[model samples]
Target: MEERKKFTFSRRGFIRTSALAGGGILLGVNFLNACKESAQPPVNIANLNFKEFNAFIKIAENGYVTIFSPNPEIGQGVKTSMPMLIAEELDVPWEHVTVEQAGLDTENFTRQVAGGSQSIRHGWEPLRQTGAIAKQMLIQAAAARWEVEPYTCTASNGVITNQAGKQLGYGDVVNDAALLPVPENAVLKDPKDFKIIGKDAINVDVHKIVTGQPLYGLDYTAPGMKYASVLRPPAFGQTLKSFDASEAKKVGGVIDVLKFGDKVAVIANNTWAAMKGKHKLTAQWNDTTLESTEDHDAKLNAILNGSKFEVRREDGNVNSAFSEADSVIERTYESPFLPHNCMEPMNFYANVTAERIHLVGPIQTPAGTAKRIAHVLERDEKEIDLEMTRMGGGFGRRLYGDFAEEAALISNGAKLPIKVVFSREDDMAAGTYRPAIKYRIKAALKDGKVTAYHLKEAAINSNMYGLIPHFFPAGAIKNYKVETGNYQSNITTGAWRAPYTNFLAFAEQSFFDEIAKELAIDPVKLRMDLLDNVNDGEDERIEYSAARMKETIKLAAEKGNWGKAAENVYQGFAAYYSHNTHVAEVVDITLQNGFPKVEKVTVAVDCGIVVNPTGAINQVEGGVIDGIGHAMYGNFAFDNGKPKATNFDAYRLIRMNETPKVETYFVENNLSPTGLGEPGLPPAGGALANAITAATGKRMLTQPFIEHFNTDTREVRG
Candidate 1:
């Protein structure tokens, strides 16, 4: 036999393997993989072997592979798509691969976050390398058995074949492969050879979701766990004075009531009893500095017109360009604070004891939440164990783990295991809403060409980040300026969906259409002309790829039949670059009973490589629908520091019958993937707005277009 080299392994290496009890191999990457026996379903961890090891892939006695996806499954489809990257490189048939959601393991995984649509973008390479290394080890094991060079031996479909026609299944040699030295580097497959990636794969949890199995946070439970319904401050800028819980204590199934800072928690045997007991309580609040929507509106408007402004970005001389211009077109757009309104209400389970703390819930930031909990409880981080359940829907809501912290605190206070559940009213009324904002866009038109561009943003709490100022149309305009101002308020606000770009894209793209109309140029042509001014690599600040953006624009225009709409059919165009992805959209609408009825939306995206076409399409369609629904009807406000709407009965959402058909096309490329979850959303609103304008000669300068144009009746609301 060839001299075999003895090697020692370190945790930092890309691949780690160990022999299983029943003559199999357990392999893990820095990202980790699944390790489950064949006797149980991949998700059923009750009988999991190698529990202490943070491994991902496990080749059992049979030729089966299980991959544990480390990121949270916030309906982004990473539970299915992340494994495809590994199975493709492993040369295993997709049918033989089983995927399971992995828990938080700080030792093996990095960037386990699910926000920013980065799960796939970040896992694209390392996940593939993991499988490639495993496949290389298996091939080497087979080569050593057959006394042939590893290069001559080939692995395919869970089997290795040597040059002399000797063959062995991965399961037959997995024990032997476990002893082989892991390769420092393994060759990756070419894009042309991809089998599972770029192909359609159904969601791994579809069966569980459709059958209403226990997968979401709402379905989680623990032995002897009591339910909690918390009553927070009734309104913004309010503090709790006192509560009379005597009547609440008398309610059936009510156990006990505990008062925490600024809130009261009702503990009961079940959620219904907890809620009932909470409703029976009488609480007094001290409301100072009570604010209203009108106040916010005035404050934002004042900031826009005020001289005090922080210039985010400036190029050339905006004053000189504006002063010398022939005409200046300025328009202001406004948006209201909105709630996430996830399908499942917020819920978390916590068990705090003298020895350790156990937490389970749907949280986007697991490690950060755990750390925060440790800080709050004055406990060591090692004593806390958190388990993430599948979320019904996040949309940036679960990014804040206030609910989890509440569960932990309530459990610690009650001295028992507790599950904190929020009612729909509680979910909406006390949500960390999307900050209300207003944008004032101005353009200096000189001799039929745009000379300068300026944008001013006034928001509720904070302004847009530095990256927004460097997005599209930055390098294209010679004299461009971006300014922002904010009014700090007591109401809490944070990231919602795509954050700044969600509304910014609408304002900027709609302004572009207005510019096209003023110049009497085709909307598509105007955008193309502006893009022609942007030179690639000339400015490092420009994050958008002009070449890629132009391709998407051209594709959307062609597919949408931009200028060839039939009579009575109105078309609108908008394009945006955000989340490192370029997207172009065209909305088509027709007058139905004198009201614009959205017919279809054509979208073209350049997100580099498409991981799973089915999941990608689903994400695109969901984003477009979400964008249209929110832009048309989503609205929230506060009256005297109290939320105006608390439930869907008062709030409005898009009806299924009113949803438009979304057609998506991708510009295929072999480059690394970018974001997908939020990119498709930003442009849909602007496209719909421009299309409505084309159908009816009205400019939409505010969100919840229903406020300006009534969808129920044929007349304008104003």
Candidate 2:
């Protein structure tokens, strides 16, 4: 057999060789050397004058076009939708374009992240410009050969035709085009003329996924790699004091026991050996002053009842409005801390040497991980190469780079390339949970209308990021005041899916439903009246689109047949705006043997513009199911500073049989797309809770509703 040729590029960051099999002209753009943070401002791809834009396009001699997508794909379908933008502006047929996931090269790609649902919002213009620039160069090359003015030539479906009727395929002129100067200006196609965007497109890697191909971080491998499992402190706020690893070293295939900080790692030749070795090790922890759940709850409630707190948002005089009210409604809603439970668990691969560190895994923040690794290993940011792999599930758990950093430290300590894997128990018990919160809301109504509202929220760790001030209904109410109290803890907390809005929407929207019933008014109409009174011009203050919210609510109600459910079915409505996307959900639920069961859900979304309709619908459907699962039975409690549910055996998850039918629809518009990942999630829990109240005369104030109903007996529990 002959030796295979290598793939090489020039020092200028452009690849100009036919080294690739099946001859083609490839164009690759390099990214600027910037800071290692994913939150960068959007780039305008219409102007090619920018010094850095790292994207790739290849015009194969066989007429096939290949584009490299530069964002990490965590099942959000950016790999498919992003390429459609490029192919559309290139004036190429969608069927002839191929998309591939690019590696993490900060010098060639910026903000390669998977969280925040920002990939489509930011990549839209830059990727399109990459294709348009390539198309311009090809047209110029063809015009130079035909000896005609470039303006007289028009390109369509990979072919350029002149006024004289002479045609040239892009593959024929790509060689000459590679030598031409990069154009400073490239005109974009009109939205009406778009052939690929806003249309349904299949995921590029669907075939590999269904055929049992290895695409996730857990399935990654490298030469002479060792597997390791770490034994972290059994509980938070504890430190390792001593360890006995003699028995672990005696285990078959066990290589060594490495100690780093408060954790000890068992390294072996394979995963099973590493796990078995880890189980045999015995470690003692110190300062195990365990805190109880009851203590934390008491502290949070005390803060909520006290007057000392930070003022997040305050409007008109709430005290005077409450004093003048005809009636007052008050309730306190609470949620427990929840874990991410990402399907594949947490695993990372790191190869460290004297020169540099190489890391790869399914992390949401690649740039942040690089920065963390550089800081930990005392190496330059450029010395670390971070490659992103498809994640099994993110849900904001992968946003932290602790796993990657730990892997790098272990690799350096062990003097070998190491793959650190977390067992299901380890991952579930690890903290970084969604902060548990308590909300005490009071609404004063006069003349059958809400006049004043006050919300006092108590939370563990940090409070919501501008949730109390910027969330909707703030401007809708005349007299509104928001206050928050916080109690710090050793347990780590961070973003989980929709973050604070996940439970906040459930609490606030459910309260609105209660108010409508007490006032003897239709719940949908009550919200609509509030929206009518809301001034859309104050968008800067409220930070939400009132028009879009109203549209989605109206559309969802119409499609779900709100207030006109069939026999044994009752409908509940809720709408919320978050992550720059507006979403409304109507749930149809029925009681079976005194237990509420969700039958169906109809969702209306206004994410401005839908890039891939199929992908957007999938996101909405999945979010609805996820929301239902959490509302029905998603929770984890702490006892003696340790999680009670260490794995799925104790903790529960929604199964296929329990999933409700979800129907999704989008509002048509020409605005730039926002995000679909987290917005669809916030309102779903609230709608389901409202439907439960409709089906059963009792309201389930607490989440995971499992405490009130028995699954086997289908009876209300005392």
Candidate 3:
């Protein structure tokens, strides 16, 4: 049915309902197609009010629409995507919608965190129904004016058009739409008629980002805001024994040296002044908390060497296969701790008062900030207002509340607004790293078929312990066992890219390469057989799209020229399903004068429905290179409790000349949209390892493949 609403004129101006706040307000919108199947009704976009405050809004006389998105937009491009959903359902021109960075208003906010790539997928339906229901009320208002049936009126591009072609702009219909009862069930547009869903839209903030406009937390300078620098423990679990800030406070711009129980913060008028004050002082550290750069290397090696933990996966007996095997192969791989090192280092601004805390910054999870700040500040949850801003890059590093703690403490002590900035070195030295892992995969095959496989992985499982409670079975392996072991490394580890998949693919796909060698079969063909050949249509749940897995592998193999090769050039392939997206990739590498030089890569994915095909492809391309960076050279060695690689000068990243040409293809599917962000990362690591193994007949279990090349056999140069 065509839907419309009318506007009401008043001295305060006309009150008109809008389809703006990301598919209109979901507060008064819900499913019109509810059966016993639905749980709640849609919100009343026209007349409904925010549960807490009298914040109900209507379209202004000028036809502007405003909505507050609670989630932070870090460079992963949420501002544009979230806004797109709202504009699409509201039937408003995309240009007409204005998104307000939602302040922490729990009563009116949605999930408010942009992690696990759940932003778009989670908001799709609620936003749609909200827009549809709002459009309905607008149509009813126009129907009253035309003296005709409401079903004969349809709304498009903010205009209500009747069957007889009589049309009225939404400004003329909002007040009327507001008066009508919110429809019980509003019809939604089907996919065939969608004008915007799958189309490409330029990033809404591209101009601001390019112009170096103040967008990130670093640029957020409030009036009278003092810059602060905190001396956090070099490693986690270490408490501050004592500190001397007398020398620090003597710096020209240094205001005060505020002590906050565990750490001392030097505050000043400018960031440079704060940094100067910090370097001018010396502090004492507890003996137990202190370790020289070389002290812990032996202990770290011991922990990796002697492992014990729970079995994350198990299938047929590994002992039985080893007992009856004609040949057995075992290889161990190790990865060093890595820092996220997002372009914009960690920074946050917080103003803490006796009654409330107003914290704003480029944070990934505002809701998390609200809870943690409320508890730490000993204030009511309502008293804390968190504002999520555009993030430079989350990559899961921004989830930690350590920076929030610093801001809150500094603000509380100084009785003024405080913004804490972590210098590139501090962000690196004040640890949170990708946990170093030691993986040992053992395979037993006879008659060219794998009978038993055992993968023993050791790392601090602290980061992904929440998300992937159980790993390995998440992958499609028939006879697989994953033994997990944790070592108490002072270097705190957290979710980076695909988290466990980083190590899992390192071990899983590396084992596959060895199994392929033992069986003398193509690696791509072997994985395809594992997914499709062993898969049933419905009976057994593999937790992955086996069919899609097969298709992606087949597609990438063809594009990568699987059956052909050039002198010194070899191809490696890997497939993984994570964050609900199935991805397969092939890396082309060659033993160039000996070191593995990546030439090009071809990747294919089945990510349900591509929300924005270009974005999806770009994300896949970026993720693959990111994974490649980790595989080829991404690492920060931990010596003792401190980082050996503190800067890009020491820690390496893949440069343009080293970056291969990435071609990504999306597998056609009729399924709903899943996430496109993290799924593309896992396969690249394994693909590079497999490609390297193919180029040089060695089971490369370790990371960076650098140590393997710098082995006793010979050294490889770039």
Candidate 4:
């Protein structure tokens, strides 16, 4: 086991404390390592004694503790889990703690974005140290009052007791502790002594979310704020030419119509009036460069066939190994563009005045978005005040701040506070989609063992990042090569969930199964043999731990009863490592009425210590369901640059009845925690595809499995 690093204060004194006006304490700790500069004492503002701090823990006279969570809450449960970290080390009872969301504070916070599942992994040590230091200060104050050494007193569960059994509550000595010097070091609790780290905790906002409270961006409203509905180009490759809004002005409650760049914004007192007025406007568009789905397919195929490629990774003599192979197996897989389909449509509230810019709503990248708004409005970044609201869902869609920028621009142009809203059609048609991609994989088998492997990817807009080629199977194969090519298009594309690995995992895992069949070996055994070839520290670029991955694979197989299911029950298996976590899954299915009926999924994860088991389970279960739903039925396409489906009525999603029961297990360990949000998804598709092939003698090489097979008569379709 790796030795854990001890948390120590910097030589410049990283902790600052201030006395509350009415006999309490406010402790501010610099949780970031880069913040070495001395911090000024927090000043009282508007009678609120607590100022902006990296992580604030305020103790009132009544012994209630409030911890401000610095990161945005995007349904990943950080609002509940992060506060648990601080409360654990502070020795405060869970019921006495209250969690609150903190505003953007660039001076104190770092890496506040919510795109990656990195909140807990990054906040583990520093947040615990914050609570530990506060406890030490309170202990010293109690020892001073007793006229004895601090080592004689112990603090636990909001109380400090001396060796003689004299006790004092934290609230009774908070004022005295606030005036003492900050301690440079405080001992963190051992894992066995932990009271709140690995336990199940309810979501802080569950009651508000379930009771229909105003918590999401669409639910947020400001005083004197007008509603806006913008009209953009109808197609991907089109630009607005001219607009006529005279008819729109005659609508009731229509305040005004303003044009910004190529988009027209309809302003009104209510959302319904704004949407109604926007529908009445007429516009002309230039579609000379419009491209269709057929165009994209042809271009991608051409790239795949051509020799113009950027080699991402190259091992020993791939060509020579292929030439000497006994046989070669090759296949191609394809996937179409996908929308994020967030439950709440894109919306933001902005008030841009001459002196300051106030922005609020659901945004993943708050500080970065504030900077972009400053650049767009030609104001200093310091003039912007940004706050984050709970999001219905992000899934990498809120990472882009275009909606926020639109709100700021509209408010600035109309000289009024504005909240921009997107209708269902607008959200779908104007979304930044997942890039369409095609992957070709080939492997050479010689002397009953795999000898060589090659993979080539052709994508629209952008190719996979450099690190993806170095993931699993790179160090295991002696002769391996990965090449990529791309064709740039006008349509926007960016990160979606796990990004490249989401589809890449399915393609590679399926290819491995085919190789296993040709070699007449069990699918799980084939993977174990490949993993045995990889050694720790052989290559610095390999991020996965072979021992940990093997453990998860074994656990999943044992729990899933691999190769031991009853008659007519088919099983498929897949394992992958991504987002600093290792996951393995087994899919169990039974055919019903010529259609695949998923029954259950067994998953094993090695993400180190589990923080908040309830939240962790929710994330894994949600990922599995999302992966299966998209793989089985999700489909999106474009005709002449126009989206084919604009609403849920046309686009199909997996219904509640189709969702399978998920059984999850974790490989318990003492290592630091890793990400859990996306790792569970990458393996689900591959496992499901393999199970479908086991049931029916057909391999699915395309997404939306519904397209390649007939649901009515169990026959292969075009």
Candidate 5:
């Protein structure tokens, strides 16, 4: 009989036994076969966790596993994808594990952010090190028990087995293992042994999503919670001069109407009451000078009309290239101020007490928002706590914490727990917008082959701008002159889904379409020839691997039957590299009662070391539809310096009927991972534009391409 080694678990819930689960419902996940040493059950699950915690570890008395993750999920499938990474290296069956959110501790973790498509790639190192260290301690304990060499003993799935097959489960000998020192250099598992890491695990929260469970920020309900609304000026830079709040206060359930510098807060017993109070409050606005969304076009035009500014990248003589060309084609493209329009509106709940403040919301950056709150409240950073809820959708809208600050202020002013709820209208009107962009693209093709190209871009700056250098540097372009400028608008614009790449793709890929038509060459072959001619992403230029670009172009063409002909379907192709991955798309479009309808889209992506292929593919499919929606009808326009497209009625969003059939394929690559969230976006507009051109034989150089659109409604206010 083997001597039983007593062990204790520090985790908070009942974990499954080591035994695997049955198939079908439990296809990807199986139950853990739990083994007990000296049974002292684990800590209460509630004691082990509270809101706003991620990335902690615990030991089960009956030896199981505990892991805490700090990021929130808005359907990017990080919950299932991230945990799969930990379980792979820990060699613990997924069912045997119990996960809890880690507390806010700066000393132990970095800022827990989920945007920028950096989730899995960023988490790879720290998590693997943790698993390796634990494996070393377990081996040492087994060596001491059997009086054998530590290296000779093998540990698999929480079991320590000697060369003779005399084994001890983790729980059986953890006390001895806990006493042993942590190893500095423990070997990691080989990639071939990773059964779970690269697999396409289903979303862990799919059940909750499909069941209509209360998982979003808007679904939050707390004891004695009140609602608050704010009265903001129309335009971005406009401010409130004075307001008559007496009418607002007279309404039923309207508690108080408090004034803050340029804004007014309406606190009431319910969301409806606050909304009612907001309407009654008559505020006198001063639009001394403000830029309406309409002014975006004129303002950008003025900036581009000015002299150019240097950004980076120079290979050959660009000035001489254009001068020597026999003929040149120059066209300017425009992208409007678009909204993310995520399903969940912008909201945040705050319970601010005298000493400490509790903040809860569906935000992208919790740790960063907490710090911002500390600065605004003038309190110690540690006193401010965040409880993150799952976002219905983020699309980069949650990156800003102005809504959280609004909640904190309303809670403090009203002297009650307050949930600041932005109505769909208010969300569309007052929220940060995607900056508008305009690009002047020029190309010179001599003897049916491309010779020289020059592009000048001018758009809003003092707004949402990525590094910009990384995607367009010498590595990404050769002899390409990109001059971008920003025309400040009153509309509060920030990062939208895919950030700056959305507009860049619209302009860059659309220009590529025009260039292809000029040379009278097949667009796919032209791109391939250009790719063969230059290196967009290389070590000397930034090392953007084009193998994926080549793979995806081939895939989309083959899948969509690019060269093949069909009567109703018009085909278009475009490729781009962003978010660390290269993607190519072939779009098929047809006219539906004069409305340009995207029928189908074929996508090929190289995201490298895909952790979840299904989820990644889903992003591409969804993102392509989102891109089409923006190109066709989506707009966040303004009226008299105030945003006019305030709700779904005025501001259109993508819906089920509008979505096209999207087929996505992944390139098999062993390179380091890249972002998948925004990589598929850049090709949507160009492909659609090409399809539209093929269908109608009309060139679209402007956004919304309203000329081709059939609508009874006149032009919008902005």
Candidate 6:
């Protein structure tokens, strides 16, 4: 008999084996704090005679495998996709796998963020290795019972088989397997032998979504939980001066009215009561110094032409290159502040006690929010339990902790569990918006080739983050310079989807189209020509994969039937690299009446190994729709320092009838997977703009292009 090695898990609830219905093995895990560097299992799962493994996997006696996905599912499908990584290496039939959503538990999980599309990218190797370790332990247990060498046993579809034709189900040996020590290292399956990854898999929540299950933050409820609505200062720089809640107190179902600096809240038995109470309350604000939208726009424009600016990236002498070039093209682009109008408006439930606080919500960053809540409550971080619910849409808006903090404050003051909900108007009026920006690009062309490029971006709050000097065209051109200018404002700005790339791609990629036209070269050929000079090496400064970038561009062009549109249909193309992913998009658009109507979109992405092709494609399609909606009609304005677009009546989104037919393709590669969440979005706007330009022979220099066109007349209104 083989000698068994004993191992113990260090986390709070590492491995706890229990009997399931019928005869089966049930395993649960908690993450080990020490095992952050590799994919090694922290505790042995095969030691079931007396002990077991940690939080993720649970194998049943009947051969069903349950995997826990520990991340927020904000319509991007990480819940269904991450578990596939583990199921693939465990060699189990995909049909036998069931996925569960895990609550926020830091001691058992690490890096549980859902933004930047990094869930799969970060969990790829470690998650697969975990499944491999579990499979090996089960194989060893089966081998011990059969009196055979472990190396001679093979496991497939949750069962182990030996060369002599003896077979045992994983459930049959899980108890003894739980007694054996875990393998120090397990070999990951080769890509060619993969049965799950890169294949189509439906979202784990699809059934619940279709059935109208309670999975969103707005649907969350707790015992004795009261709904609360807040009346915040209307303007960015304003504060509450005075309020009269006399009439609000008479509203039916109204429980209590509380006041916090700069805001007032009405707590009631239900949502409608709270909303009515808030509407009835009379309030006045001190808006003496509030700045209007025009003020901010003028400041940004002044900074763009001003001399005070910081150079972020400079290579070779751009001045000299321009002086020596045959022609220099300069154009400016602007994008306005836009809101993240999530289908489910901002809402959070918080229960506060003297000892601890419980927070549940649809947030993008739970850990960060927990820390902020702890600070606000003056409690230790460990005392707060932050649980994330499925978000209708995050789009980088939930990253802020303001809403969660408000809920905590209300709960603490009321001494009860309270759910803070924002109506459509409130969410739009108070949310942090994407920063408006001005981009000026100058390209020096010599003999039909881009020799030098310069870019200066000016913004009201702050410049784009992660925008390095060596961004795209950095290595493609000899002389490059990137500069930034800043103007101060009271408007709160935060990340929106792809962040800077959302607007930057529209500016840079569309400018490239202009350069291509000036040089009388096909846009595709111009891009490929520029890419020819890019070095494909292990350079840290190279933000984009030259090979992969070229691949996506060629693939998108081919799949889109580039330059083959009919007389009335025009095709425009744009490619971009962000979040370690390369994406190329081609838009087929036609002028309907006076407005550009997007007919179809073709996208090619290279984000390394795609874990779930179906989910990946869904993300691409949704991102394209989001991009087009914002570019066509999404814009927020301010008058007297108050948000103008406070509801759907003023804020418009892409309807189903207007959404284009989107087709997505992926390049096959053996590299580790990256994020697809935000990459597909950055180039969509640029491609649509390019297509519009092609159709009308006019360039859209400012975003929310709907504002500049007369839809009924088919002419420019600007």
Pick the lDDT winner: 4
lDDT of each model, Cα atoms only? 0.86, 0.82, 0.70, 0.87, 0.70, 0.83
TM-score, each model?
0.95, 0.93, 0.88, 0.97, 0.88, 0.93
lDDT of each residue in 272-361, candidate 3, tens digit only: 999999887677666455443244444445654675556755666778778998898888777767788888899999999877788888
Question: RMSD, each candidate, Å?
Answer: 4.6, 6.5, 5.6, 1.8, 7.3, 4.3
What TM-score does structure 6 among the candidates reach? 0.93
Better of 1 and 6 by lDDT: 1
Model 4 / residue 662 / CA error / Å: 0.3
Alpha-carbon runs more than 4 Å astray in model 4: 1-5, 11-14, 32-39, 44-51, 463-467, 712-718
Give candidate 3's TM-score. 0.88
Task: Report the C-alpha lDDT of model 5 over 37-91, residue by residue, as the tens digit.
Answer: 2222224333332232225344454667766556777678777777777677556
Tens-digit lDDT track of model 2 for 1-718: 2232222222343323333344556666432222233323223323322213255677887678988766778888888888888788788888898887666765545567887887778766656665676788889999999999999999999999999999999888877786676676577776776778888899888988899798889999999899999999988878999999999999999999999999999999999999999999999989756766787789888998898788989999999999999999998988889999988889999999988788889988888889888888888887887778888888999998888888999999999999999999989888579988888889999999999989888888755454547778878898999988888887888899988889999989899998998889998988888877678776567878778889999899999999899988988888998888889999998887888788999999999878899999999899889988898889888887789999898998888888899999999887788888888888888898888888776677888887779889888665
Residue-wise C-alpha lDDT for candidate 1, range 257-294, written one tens digit per residue: 99989999999999999999999999999988889999
Which candidate model has the greater TM-score, 5 or 6? 6
Quality of model 4 by C-alpha lDDT: 0.87
lDDT of model 2, residue 281? 94
TM-score order, best first, reads 4, 1, 6, 2, 3, 5
Better of 1 and 2 by TM-score: 1
Worst 10 residues of 5 by lDDT: 23-32
Consecutive 10-residue window with the lowest summed lDDT within model 4: 42-51
Given candidate 2, what's the lDDT at residue 672? 82
